[model samples]
Structures are given as C-alpha cells and as structure tokens.
Target chain A: MTEQLVIMVLLSFLVVIAFGIILLKDLLVAVILSGIYSLTAAAIFVVMDAVDVAFTEAAVGAGVSTIFLLGALTLTRRQQKQQKHNNYFALLVVTLTGALLIYGTLDLPGYGDGQSIANQHPQLAQHFLQKSEDEIGIPNVVTSVLASYRGYDTLGETVVVFTAAIGVLSLLGLRRRKREEDPELDAKRQCRQQNEEV
Target chain B: MKYLALYNYWIVVIIMMAGFYIMIARHNLVKKIIGLGLFQTGIFYFYVSLGKVDGGTAPIFVESLEAQATVYSNPLPHVLILTAIVVGVATMAMGLALIVRIYEKYDSIEEDEIKAIERQHWQENNGEFGISLTAPPTASS
Candidate 1:
C-alpha cells in the first residue's frame, strides 16, 4: 500500500519533469530537463522491481548521453533561429492520436496485473523461469535472446557499423592525405571572404 | 497499483514519442541528438520494463550464494540492457565524433545556420565552378 502511494507521487513528479522539458525555451535547460525525466523514469522502474532497467536508465540515459549531448552542443549554437508557427491541422492530428491511444488503453490489463499476457505465456516466459539453465546454458533470459536466438542479427548490426565506417572513410579522406577537394570548401571560403569584406 | 504498472507502458510510449517529435521538429542539431538520445532511452526503458516480475527482488545470483534466493526478478533484462547501454554509449560517442566533423565543415553548428551556409555554399560554387571542378569535400574519404 505504501509502495502504491510512493509510486504515485514519483509518477506525478515525472509528468511534471516531462512538462518542464516541453515548456522550457532554452535548449540547454530542455536537455537537462530531459535528463531529469530519464532519472525519474529510472526511479519508477525501481519501484516496479525493474532494477536492471533502472541501472541502464541512470547510466546510459542520464550519464553517457548527457555528456555526449554537451560535447555535441559545444560544436554548435543554442538559440533556435526560426520560430515555429502553430498550425491547427497539426494540433488536430496530434489530439486525435492521443484520444485514440487513451481509448485503446481502456482495454489494457490493470497495472502489474498477474494475469498479463507477459505472465500468462508459459512456453515463452515461464520456460525461462523453469528451464533456462539446461537448455540455453545461460541464467539470464535476455542474454539467451540477444546472444543466441538473435545473435546473427546483432552480428549483422555490427557489419552495418563497419559499412558506415568505410563509407565515412571513403567520403572524407584524411586531411593530410587528401586535401578537401570539395568545391563547397571553396564556397565556404568565399562566404568567409564575403563576411570578411562586410 | 496494478493499474499503474499497466499504464507505465504509456509513459514509455509518451517519452519515446516526445523524443521522436523533438528529433524531427526541432531545428537545432544538438537538440536533435538529444532527442535521438531520449527516443533511444525510451525504447531501452520499454525493453527493461517488460522483464519485471511482481513480488520480485534483484538478480544478484552467485553459485556459492543461493541462500537468499527469493522470488527475484529476471536478470536477463539487466544484463541485456547492460550491453545496450554500452552500445548506446559507443553510438553516442560516434555521433559526437560526427558532430565534430560537422562543426568543421559547416563552421556554424546550428542546423538552420548550417543549412543556410550549405545552401549558400551550393549556390556560390554551383554558379561559379559547376562540374568543371571536382566534387565538394564531404566527410567521406
């Protein structure tokens, strides 16, 4: 019972954080608020007995990503250049989607309800609980899923990474090796030159 | 309280959508990356949330330490997401690396500024040089 009360409070706090992210005008503050939202979600995961997820949320969502964003932002400017205009048609589409989502949720099972499709599936989930050791030889079901069942897919993903690296290498040769042959560089030089003239 | 768990999925969905919206709608490149980060985290949370078992405890299992083996939650999600977090970190690192290159190319990191600069660059070079000159220098090799 106490858990329920505590969770409700935290959830409200999360909603507030989300709204804060949305409402903030400053881009830096918005990013920071987004971190708060991730932390709040982590806490909520802990409340729901998802400590692993909470750890990931705290580490990746809050820690590493924050640093990455800050680094990226250093190379960029903050202030939004063009103001976004409100269009009623876009609003209606968003609203209708939200309404439909709410309506769909009406049929969902109650929170943490034991009889959820997640829990009910014996062959899928219960098997993990029962025979995870003998069959897959791994205690962690997620590992079994990611490493074995979908291992090939992850390998393919790594290949995609390699492909991207090659693409970048071929497109942007090293500075000393091959000077930027791009006429765009010339144009930027021209722009800089023009700016200097002004 | 059970109802809240059911609704938690909605929170994940909302976070994901908000992140997606920010990534797409916002003109700022850094904000777009942040949006991408948010959106990725939302999916991570969703996957992690799916493994929660009611009345469960943490999964600190040791071969020598099964004495406290209560109804512990699944360890798989934690382990899986651990890898995911590492991958995400690596990906974000690579993204920032790309942003560094973007900064070098465009001079101005602001998306709108970069766009303007690129457009202006295209017009200036295209009118003056055309294909008579070599391809413009992209980040590629």
Candidate 2:
C-alpha cells in the first residue's frame, strides 16, 4: 500500500513535469524541468525494483543529457518563438493516438503480476535467471546477460555510440576549427594572395 | 482496485504522448529534442515496469544462495533498456548536432520560417525558368 502510494506520488510529479515541459516558453527552464522529470522517473524505477535502471537514468538522462542540452542552448536561441497559431491538427492527432494507446492497455496484465508472460517466459528471462550463475559464473544476472548473453548486441550498441560521436565531431568540429583559426595566419594568407595577384 | 492496477501504464502513456505532442507541435528544435528524450524515457519506464514482479527484488544474486529462495525481477528488460538508454542519448546528440548545423545555415531554427525561405528561393528560380520557356513559346505563336 505504501509502495503504491509512493509510486502514485512520483508518477503524478512526472505528469506535472511533462506539462511544464510542454507549456514553458523559456527553453532553459524547460530543459531543467526535463532533468527533474528524469530524476523522478529514476526514483520510480527504484521503487519498482529496477535499481540499475534507476542509476543509469539518473546518470545519463538527468546528468549528461541536461548538460548536452545546456551546451546546445549556448549555441542556439534561449527563447522559443511565439507560435502564430495553435496547432489544432497536432493536438487532435496526439489525442486520438493517446486514446488508442489507453484502449490497448485495457487488456494488459496488471502491474507487478508475477505470473505475467514477460516474467515467466521460460526461454528468455527464466533462462537467464537460472543458468547465468552456472554458465557465466556471474552472480548478477543482468551483468551476465548483458556481457555474456547479449555481448554482440552491446558491441553493436558501442559501435552505434562510436558512430554517433564521430558524426557529432564531423558536424560541429569544422566550425570549431574555423572559429579557432589564428587571426595572424588569416592575415598572412590574405597578404600572400594579394602579392600573387599583383 | 482492478483499474488501479494499470495506473503505471496509464501514466507512461500520458508521458509518452506529451513528448510526442511536443515533438510534433513545438517549432523549437531543442524542445523537439527534449521531447524525444522524454518519449524515450517513457518507453523505458514501460519496459522496466513490465519487468517488475510482486515480492521480488533486484536481479543481483546474494552471497549465501542456499539459505532462502530469492525471487529476482526479470533482468532482460533492464539489459535491453540499458542499451536503449545509451542509444537514445546518442540519437539525441546527433539530433542536436544536426539542429546546430541547421541553425548555422538558415539563421533560424523554427521550421515554418525555414520553409518560407526555401519557398521563396524555389519561386525565384521557377519564375526565371518559366519566363524563359513561355517567352519562346509566345514568340513562336
């Protein structure tokens, strides 16, 4: 009962933060609100017994992403432009889609049901829980599953991260080089060009 | 009580839709990226919620394994969502980088203004081409 009450409070906080993110015109405040949202979600994850996920959420979602956004803000405008008109079409579409999703959830297994298919699936979750100690010799099932069972997927994910880093470097690195060029060197190059023209 | 059982899922849906709305309706590129982050977090919440089991604890095994049977919540979703969270951050970084470049090119991040500029450029080029083709046709006629 207490657990449910705690979760309820956190989830309500999440909902309120989401609304804040949507309605706030100041981009900076919106970004900070998003960080709070991530932290609140992390707390809920902890209450739900996903401590590892909660840790990662706190680190990446609340920490790195917020910093990345603040850095991006330094390069872009801080205030969103006033929209000329309300986007009724988008509102309608979002409402309909949300309604359909809510309808789909009507038949889902109740929260924390131990007999749910996902929890009892023999081949996937159960296999990991049962055999991870013997096969991988790792007590932590998540580590064994992530490193030994899903090693290739993690490798692919690493590759994806590497590629993203390279992409960001290539995209923003050129401007940094141009901005950092020495003024004396620029003048020297111009002088050389003028001498050549004469 | 039955209806309350699915409360977590309902909230997840609401959060996800809020992000979706922001992504589609907001003109600011940074806000759109933030929305994308929120949407990803909501999906993460859904997955983590699915992995929960009543009376279960975290997936880490204890030192004394023989004393009592321990029920650990499903670890698969944690693994999957861990990978997803990292990947989502990567995607956000890439999106932000693209936004930075777009701002550099267009001097504005708002989608409507950029579209208007592009439309003006298209009209200018099309008008030149149409004038040349119609001039020849009218002279021949």
Candidate 3:
C-alpha cells in the first residue's frame, strides 16, 4: 500500500516536470529540465519494479542524451525565437488527440491485473517463462527472451542504431579530417562576416 | 476504486500527451528532439505498466528447490523497451546532427527565420515561390 502511494506521488511529480519542459522559454534551462525529467521517470520505473528499464533510462536518457543535447546547444542560440503568431492549430490538434487517447484507454485492462489478456495468455510469454530456465538455462527471463527468443529483433535494433550512427557521422563529419568543410568553422566565418558588415 | 485501478495507465496517457504537445508547439529544433525522447519514454512506461502483475516480483530467479511457484513480472515488455531506449538515443543524435547542419546553412535555427530565408532565395532564383520542375534548356544542353 505504501509502495502504491509512493508511486502515485512520483508519477504526479513526473507530470509536473513534463509540463515544465514544455512551458519553459529558456532553451538551455529546458534541456536541463528534460534531463531531470528523465531521471525522475527512471525513479518511477524503479518503484514499478522495472529495474532494467530504469537502468537504460538512466544511462541513455539521462546520461548520454543530456550530454549530446548540451553539445548541440553550443552550436545554436541559447534562447528560442518568439513567433509572431500563436500556434492555436497545434494546440487544437494536441487536445483532440489527447482526448481520443483518454477515450481509448476506457477499454484497457486495469493496472497490474494478473488476469489481463497479456498475462493470462499462454503463448509466447508463457513459453518464455516456463521453458526459459530449462531451454536457455538463464535465470533472468528478460535476458533470455531478448538474447535468445527475440534474437532477430535485437539484431534489427542494433542495425538501426548503427545506421543512425552512420547518418550522424556523415552529417557532422570528423573534425580532424577536413577543418575547412566543417560547419562550426563556417559559422565562425559567417560571424566574422557579419561583424565586418556591421 | 475502479479509477484507482487504472490510474497508472491514465498517468501514462497524460504524459504521452504532454510530450506530443511539446513536439508540436515548440519551434526549437532541439526541444522537439527532447519532446521525441519524452514521447518514447512515455510509451515505454505504458508497456512496462501493463506488464506489471499484482503481488509479483522482478523476473530474476532465486536458487531454491521451491522456486517454481514464484510469480514474476512479465519480461517481454522490458526486453522491447530496452531495445527502444538505445534506438531513441541514436535517433536523437541524428536529429541533433541535422539541426547543426541547418543552423550552419541558414545562419539561424529558428524555424520561421529559416523558412523566410528559403522563401527569399526561392523568389530570387525561380522568380516565384514554387519549385520549377521543367527546366529551361541551358546553353550546354
């Protein structure tokens, strides 16, 4: 019971942090707030007993991505430019989509219900739980399923990561190879040009 | 009581919407990428919440002869989400790279300013605001 209460409080705090990220004007502050938001969400995941997910969220969402975003921030303006007109259309679209999602949630099984279709079904999940220990001889069902049962899917995900890495490298090429082709150098030249024009 | 039973999923829905709102309303390219990360995390939370079983523990096994009857949380969603988190980070890196390039060429990362600059260049070159699919033959051609 106390665990549930703690989860509820943490979940509410997460909602507040998400709102803070959306409403804050200073882009640098917003980036930092987004990192905090990831850490808080990871805490909530830990309370829910999703320790592995929490670990990934801490390492990827909070640690690496925050550093990547900060590095990107140095290349752009610190503040977001204000628009002349309000984004009413965007607000309307988001509201309608959110309402639809809430309406769709009405039919979902109750939280943590053991008899839910996903849990009660004796197909893939059951096979993993029952046979994983004997077949794969691994105690951690998630590790067995990820590394053995869904090995192909994991391979595809790894490939996707590799492709994304290649794309980023091509866009923001290596610094030592061609300093003249680098955009950071181009940005410096443009800055000097602007000063001369002024 | 029924609402309490499903409060977890509702929280997931609300967080998902907040992320969507940020992705749509924010003009900053980096913030949009951050919103994308939030949206993906909300999705992970939803799946992980659904996988939870009442009175169940984490899926790791204990060494005992009587370990057969232990109820463990579903591990499928955790595996899927583990893969997803890695992919999300990689995608965000790609997005930030593109944003850097956009900032370099346009001299601004503001969406409106970039659009205005493109429009001015288009008018100057094509003599109108639309693309010219049919090319006028050049001297070499």
DockQ of candidates 1 onward, in order?
0.32, 0.37, 0.46
Query: Residue by residue across A42-80, what tens digits does model 1's lDDT show?
Result: 887787666656777788778767776675665454554
Worst 10 residues of 3 chain A by lDDT: A176-185
TM agreement with the true structure for every prediction: 0.70, 0.88, 0.88
| Model 1 regions more than 4 Å off | A82-93, A133-198, B1-5, B59-87, B121-141
For candidate 3, the share of real interface contacts preserved is: 0.71
**Each candidate's iRMS in angstroms?**
4.8, 8.3, 4.5
Question: Candidate 3 regions off by >4 Å?
Answer: A176-198, B64-68, B127-141
Candidate 2 vs 3: which has more lDDT:
2
Instruction: State the fnat of model 2.
Output: 0.78
Q: Model 2 reaches what TM-score against the true structure?
A: 0.88
Screening candidate 2 with a backbone cut-off below 3 angstroms (N, C-alpha, C), the clashing residue pairs are none
Shift in Å, residue A40, candidate 3: 1.2
True contacts kept of each: 0.28, 0.78, 0.71
- For model 2, residues A1-198, the per-residue Cα lDDT tens digits are 788889989999999999999999999999999989889888998998888888889999899999999988988679997787899999999999999999999999888888999999999999998888889998888889889999999999999999999999988885453322333334333433443354
Residue A175 deviation, candidate 2, in Å?
A: 5.1
